[model samples]
Target chain A: MATVELTFSALPAHVRTARLVATAIARRTGVEESLLDEVRLAVGEACSRAVEAHRLHCPGEPIRIELRDDLGRFEVTVTDSAPSDELEQERELLRFDDPLGQLPDTLMTGFGIAVIVGLADDVQVYPSQKGMRIRMSWPAATNGLSPV
Target chain B: MDLKLDHHSEDRLTIVEVEGEIDVYTAPRLRELLIDLVNKGNFHLLVNMEKVDFLDSTGLGVLVGGLKRVRAHDGSLELVCTQERILKIFRITGLTKVFGIYASVEEAKEAHGRDK
Candidate 1:
């Protein structure tokens, strides 16, 4: 297994870089093309949400991302260093499942988790000692859902 | 990456040609452009996304915000998108039902012309 770790300031500009790096790592795992697109978007959404959370509650701390390629599967973990209370609040806002029509104008901006969940094959969230962590993973070969 | 926006006006309908990735970093610029157009009384808008390679929730949020802005003026906002990758984002968020998505820019223009 190969692992790559990246730490960058929780800023919007850095989100693009994070997505590009994650996509590169995923590509090397020989994942399907369509699944790679999902990986790109999932990583972007995760980093964007983390950056927003850090901006609101925890500033000056860098967001950490870990990419692991186990030859058969690829995994990514995005960690945010917000305080425990702020992390809880952010998780609540992100885990929402309301339809778009039911959401208020202010809440329409909070669809990061839904995007991630729709793309990744598996997702897990946990409260770390420093803050919170979100892990997303996908198999190297997705079945017939994608074109061969 | 940054966004590329090229717009032209025809009879009150403004068509914006958007290319490149649309994410958190680039979405704010798109949002500002749409707001400026709405502020200048350009309401009926159709964004051409045939060239947009990527879009996330932040980009979708800007489109939804633009839709609300134009609707407030009794106008409409639509999109010209053919790519499955970009369309999937809209479908996943249930935005396909909210915004008018046409197969081509000409189709969108003809529909609006018929409405008038």
Candidate 2:
């Protein structure tokens, strides 16, 4: 088991840095190329959302990212200040009304959240006084274990 | 990322081959490419994505915006996607119905050639 942690002052530039870190971690952990790509996309979406939340609501706050690899399972957790109660409530009530039974394409809605949930095997959200924490995980058993 | 621009006929059709990831970081380049192509009066656009590995919401937004911009000028935009993940994103987002997606660049070229 190996763990890597990084914290940044919630900026747009860190999005690319987070993806690069995930790629390096996946390479070091011997995760498969396809699975790594999935992880990268999932983590990228997660971090981008977190950054957006920080910028919009909790301005000037720091965002933390933790990556953990336990043999075949990889987990990424992003923590940032909680958004306003009104926005959180609004997000909770929002649902995709896709008439075609496909993912919703609402331009200003839960597109990033949908991407994170769809791409990751497990997703957990925890809200505390300190902030909100989002965690996404992938099981190597299902995604293959060969490194790219 | 490399973007190769090709023009067919007297500015009737434009082909842009995008090779790389299309995420938040790279979507600006795509947006610029689309804007440039549209500004040049080459509205019939086909984006060759055979080599693109990944795309995110930002990329999708750019494409959607590009389509709208092209349509505003009475032009059409098509896509040539062979990658499974990219195709899956398009399918999930219902963009396959919004854009003309062909199996290969050659097929897209052929279809566009017929339109000409």
Candidate 3:
């Protein structure tokens, strides 16, 4: 398994850089072209959220992202130093069948989580004392991300 | 890439042409432009997103905030989007039903006239 690691200050400018790097690695890992956009969007959303969290409370902190390509699975782990309570709240919100079912008002907000869920094959959220770790993965056994 | 925002007239509509990416970093620029247009009494807005390469939730929030701004003036905020990739984000977020998305600026203007 090969892994690419990235760490950057919690700045919005670095979000695109992160996306570009993630897409480059995902493509190299054999993630399908059709799903490239998904990887890009998912990474952007995750990075943006981390940046927001850091800017709010832990200014100047670094956000860490890991892109791992195993034999049959490719995964991204984004670790942010946002408040643990905020991360827990986000986890609870994800439990909703349709967090967007509320209304356009609420829909316009907290939309990134929904986007991540739709694009990734698997999503795992763990709120740690430091902050949150969002694990999103796509399997390559499908000739998509992981190789058989 | 960065977000490039420019506006022009299409019949009775004000078309904001967006290029490049829209994320948390650049979305505020878009929000400011949309709000500026509204503040200057330009309301019938149709955002032309043909060249928009990327859009995330923050970008959508800006669009929705613009919509609210125009709606208060009894005006409208629509979109000219033909890219299926961009459209899918709206669909997944349930925003496809909120904004009036057209394939071209002409169609959006035509639809605007009919609404009058």
Give the top-scoring candidate (TM-score): 3
lDDT (Cα, tens digit) per residue for candidate 2, span A1-148 = 5689998877766787898898778666666667777788778877776776777777688888998886577778988885635445545654444322222233422556667777788898675656778898876543334445
User: What lDDT score goes with residue A21 in model 3?
Assistant: 93
Please give the TM-score that candidate 2 achieves against the real structure: 0.78
Every candidate's lDDT: 0.83, 0.72, 0.83
Off by over 4 Å in 3: A87-109, A141-148
Score residue A85 of candidate 1 by CA lDDT.
57
lDDT of 1: 0.83
Model 3 pairs in collision = A140-A145, A140-A146
lDDT of 1 by residue, A1-148 (tens): 6789999998899999999999887877667677989999999998987887788777799999999876577889999986545445544564234333333323433467778888899999776557778899998743212232
**Model 1 reaches what TM-score against the true structure?**
0.88
i-RMS values of the candidates, in order? 3.0, 4.0, 3.7
Candidate 2 CAPRI assessment class: acceptable
The best candidate in terms of DockQ: 1
True-structure RMSD, every candidate: 4.1, 4.5, 3.5
DockQ agreement of candidate 3 with the native complex? 0.48
